[model samples]
Target: MIDIHSHILPFMDDGAADYDAALGMAQDALNDGISTVVATPHHANGVYMNPAGEIEESVRVLNAKLQEAGNPLLVLPGQEIRIYGDLLDDLERGQLLSLAGSRYILLEMPSSRVPRSMEETCHELIIQGYVPVIAHPERNAEVAEDPSRLVRLIELGALGQLTAQSVAGTFGSKLQKLSLELCRRQAVHIIASDAHDQLHRPFGLSEAYGVVKRELGSDAFDFFQQNSRKIITNEEVIRANPVQSYNKRHRLFGIFSRKG
Candidate 1:
C-alpha cells in the first residue's frame, strides 16, 4: 500500500526526532503493509518551513538510510503546506512541493475553522492544474460541525484525506464517527497515516482499511486504496457525487461501491 502523507523524515519538523527514530518509524510502516511513504513534513505552517528543495534532499537521505538497512520501503518527497494567501505565489516560486512530484498538492487548514479563502484558493489551484487535497478534514471542527462545508470544497475540485488514526478511533469515538460520516458522504478520497511517532501517532492505514471494509464493505476499501495509487501517478481520481444534504437517518445508504 502507498501512504500518501507522513512525517518520517528525521529532523525535518515535529516528526521523527533523529535517524534512529525515523528508521523505527519506517519499520513500523513496513509491518503495516505500507510499501511507499511520502515524507510530508510541515511547510510554511508558522512553526515549520520545509522548502521543496530541502524536502527533496531530506527524502534522498532517508531513502539512502533505508537502503543501507536493507529496507524495501520507498520514501518520496512531499510537503504538507498550510493554506495561506501567498500560497499561489509560493507555488509559482517553486518553493512548494507536490506529493511525489505529482500534480496533487497536500494542503492543511487550521483545525479550528475552515479558511475564508479556501474556496478561492482551491479554485485557483485547480485552474493552475494542481489538485489541492485537504488533509484530515474529518478532524477539523468546522467540518465536524457541518459536513456540507467539506462537500462544498469537494465541489470546488478539492479532495479530502482522512488520517488513518481518526478512522481507527485512535483520536476518539466521536472523530471515528465523523470520519465514517465523511466516507459515507463521499467527501473524502484518501486514507493516510499522518504518523508522527510510533507511540503518539503510529501507522494505522491497515487498521483503518479493515474498518472501512467491515463497516462500509470491501468496495470502499478498494476505492481509497486505488485512489492512493492514482494520486502518486498523477492520474485523475474517480470522485463519486457527494451527498450534499447529509441525513443522519441515512448513514449507511451511500457507502462507496466499485465505480468501474
Candidate 2:
C-alpha cells in the first residue's frame, strides 16, 4: 500500500523527532504492510516551512538509511501544504511538492474552520492543472458539523482523504462515524496514515482497511486502494458521483425515519 501523507522526515516538523524515530516510524509502516510512504512534512503551515527541495533531500537521506537498515519500504517526497493566499504562486515557483511528484497535491485546511476562499482556491488549482486533495477533512471541526461543505468541495473537483486513525475510531466514535458516512456517500477518495510517531500516531492503514472492507465492502476497499496507487503514479483517478447531504430526519429518528 502507498501512504500519500506522512511526517516521517526527521527535524522537519512535528512528526518524527530524529532519525531514530523516523526509522521506527518506517518500521511501523512496514508492519502495517505499507511498502511505499510519502514523507509529507508540513509546509507553510504557519509553524513549519518545508520547501520542496529540502523535502526531496530529506526523502533521499531517509531512503538511504532505510536501505542501510535493510528495510524494504520506499519513502517518497511530498508536502502537506496549508491553504494560503500564495499557494498558487509557490506551486508555480516550484516551491511546493506534490504527492510523489505527481499532479495530486495534499492540501491541509485549518482545523478550526474551512477558509472562506477555499472553494475558489481549489478551483484555481484545478484551473492550473493540479488536483487539489483535501487532507483529513473529517478532523476539521467545521466540516464535521456540516459535511455538505465537503460535498460542495468535491463537486468543485477537489478530492478528500480521510486519516486512517479517524476511520479506525482512534480519534473518537464521532469522527469514525463521520468518516464512515463520507465513505458511504462516496465523498472520500483516499485513506492515509497521517502517522507522526511510533506510538501515538502509529500506522493504522491495515486496520482502517479492515474497517472499510467490513463496513463498506470489498469494492470500497478496492476503490480506495486503486485511487491511492493512481495518485502516486500520476494517473487520472476514478471519481464517484457527487455526494449528497445525509437526511436530517435520519439523524434524529434512525433508519426508520420517514421522508417528510
Candidate 3:
C-alpha cells in the first residue's frame, strides 16, 4: 500500500527524532503492509519548516538506508504544509513540495478551526494547477461539529485524506466515528497513515483498511487504496458522489449527546 502522508524523515519536525527512530518507523510501516511512504514533514506549520529541496534530500538518504536494510519500502518526498497566505507564492518559488513530486499537495488546516480564507486559498491553488488534499479533517473541531465544512471544501476541487489512526480509533472513539462517517458519506478521498513514530503514532494502515472494508465494503476499500496509488503517480483519482449536507443542529446535538 502507498501511504501519502507520513513524517518519517529523521530530525525533521516532530516526527522521527533521529535516524534510529526513522528506521523503526519504516519497519513499523512495513509490518503494516505499507510498501511506499511519502515523507511529509511539517512545512510552514508555525513549528517546523521543511523546505522542498531539503525534504527531497532527506527522502533520498532515508530511501538508501531502507534499501540497505532490505526493508523493500520506498520513501518519497512530500510536505504537510499548513494553509497560509503565501502558499501559492511559495509553490511558485519552489519552496513548497507536492506529494511525491506530483501536482497533489497535502494541506493541513489549523486543528481547532478552519481559516476564513481556506476556501479561497484552495480555489487559488486549483487555478494554479495544484490539487490540495486536506489532511485529517475528521479531527478538526469545527469539522466534527459541522461536516458540511469538509463537504464544501471537497466541492471546491479539494480532496480529503483521513488518517489511519483516526479510522482505527487510536485517537478516540469520537474521531473514529467521525472518520467512519466521512468514509460512509464518501466525503474522504484517501486513507493514509500520518504516522509520526513507532510507539505513540504507529502505522495503522492495515487496520484502517480492515475497518473500512468491514464497515463500508470491498468497493470502498478499493476506492481509497486506488486513490493513494494514483496520488503518488500523479493520476486523476476517483471521487465518489458529492456528500449530502446534513442538518447542522441535529447532527451536532447527536454527536455531542452520544454515549461513550
Best by lDDT: 1
Clashes of 1: 0
Query: Model 3 — which ten-residue stretch has the worst lDDT?
Result: 251-260
lDDT of 3 by residue, 1-260 (tens): 99999989998899999988999999999988899999999999898988898999889999999888989999999999999888888988999999998989999999999999999999999999989999999988899999989989998899999999999888889999999888766678999999999888888899999888777677678889999999999999987555433324345332212233
lDDT of 2 by residue, 164-236 (tens): 9999999999999999988866678999999999889988899999988877777678889999999999999
Clashes of each: 0, 0, 0
Model 2 lDDT at residue 124: 93
Provide the lDDT at 171 for model 2.
92
Candidate order, TM-score descending: 1, 2, 3
How many steric overlaps does candidate 2 have? Answer: 0
Score each candidate by Cα lDDT: 0.91, 0.89, 0.88
The list of candidate 1 runs beyond 4 A from truth reads 244-260
TM-score top scorer: 1
Per-residue lDDT, model 3, residue 61, is 93
**What stretches of model 2 exceed 4 Å from their correct place?**
243-260
- Estimated TM-score for each candidate: 0.94, 0.93, 0.93
